[model samples]
Target: MTDDKTLVSRVLQGDMQAFRLLIGQHERLVAHMIGRLVKNNEEREELCQDVFLKVYEKLSDFSFQSKLSTWVATIAYRHAINWMRKRKMPMTDLAEEDHFKAAFVEEENPESLLSDQDMNGFVMTLVDALPPQYKTILTLYHVDAMSYDEIGQVTGLPEGTVKSYLFRARNLLKEKVKKCIGKEELL
Candidate 1:
């Protein structure tokens, strides 16, 4: 496995294979960032492609100040945000906790009555309903195993803000799961 600096240097020199390698390495990070926010599969796929294209175009500008993955994630985050803005989607701020909680929790649906096997999918659905910032931070920290600082680099939030959001996001999911479990017991 080549180091990121070597791979980036080769890509900057017009090495197509190195560029492919870069894409292969960071593709999951890009997909997870976009997937957490964008619901449409086609759009998500296209957005991932666009992110790499932008990476390639700007490869020379990468100064190695951050890990290659973190830089790529930043691009992915910005692209997803721009896409959402263009579509007139609500970019809800995390400060609106009451509004977020009210909108997120609702009457139990048929899908919420899941057996253990379906619990993972049910939890993901709850995560999907969260605002984009919360979803992005959760995905970056948990799915990608990134540190709060790395997540902050990607999302342009402070480390403290990242930690706060991650904590709040987990708490929100916990409450939702507990609510579902309590309701399931009544059935």
Candidate 2:
């Protein structure tokens, strides 16, 4: 089991198995990014595969001027953008969205949202249901624990916009959490 740098060097030397090692080292990373950036399960799966393929094809271009993760993230961001363009969704501000209002607009009863497991699951499902713009922002902010500037870099949005998106996403989740918790009393 070689390290990433060693494996990268081997892959550069034309060893097919080196690619495997690279995938093994970064598969979870690729999946995490895909899952966060893409809400649709099918597209998430496809995008992950595409990222790995792109990584394999572009191995020669990696000059070690930057870390491997950064290079991979750059590819993922580009692919995600291309995917969004293909889907015909023009740029939209998720910060301006009232996600909870858009999804549950009406006041839901406590029971309507109560078990801790049920509450957590429902909130996560709701996040998953967010539009890609919001979902990507939420995922990058929460799941990846990325900073606003980092998220802005990845999403090609302004740092202020990234901050606003995260703020909005958290507010939406807080509301959902409250509703889910209320179910115990609503019952």
Candidate closest to the true structure, highest lDDT: 1
The estimated TM-scores of all candidates read 0.89, 0.73
Per-residue lDDT tens digits for candidate 2, residues 72-159, read: 7667877877887888855455545554456564565555544434755666777865656677778767776677766776677899
Per-residue alpha-carbon lDDT of model 1 for 1-187, expressed as tens digits? 8999999999988899999999999998999999998999999999999999999998899998999999999999999999999999988877775645665546755353575347668778778877889988988888899999899999999999999999988877777667757654432
- Decoy 1 TM-score against native: 0.89
Stretches of candidate 1 off by over 4 Å are 98-112, 183-187
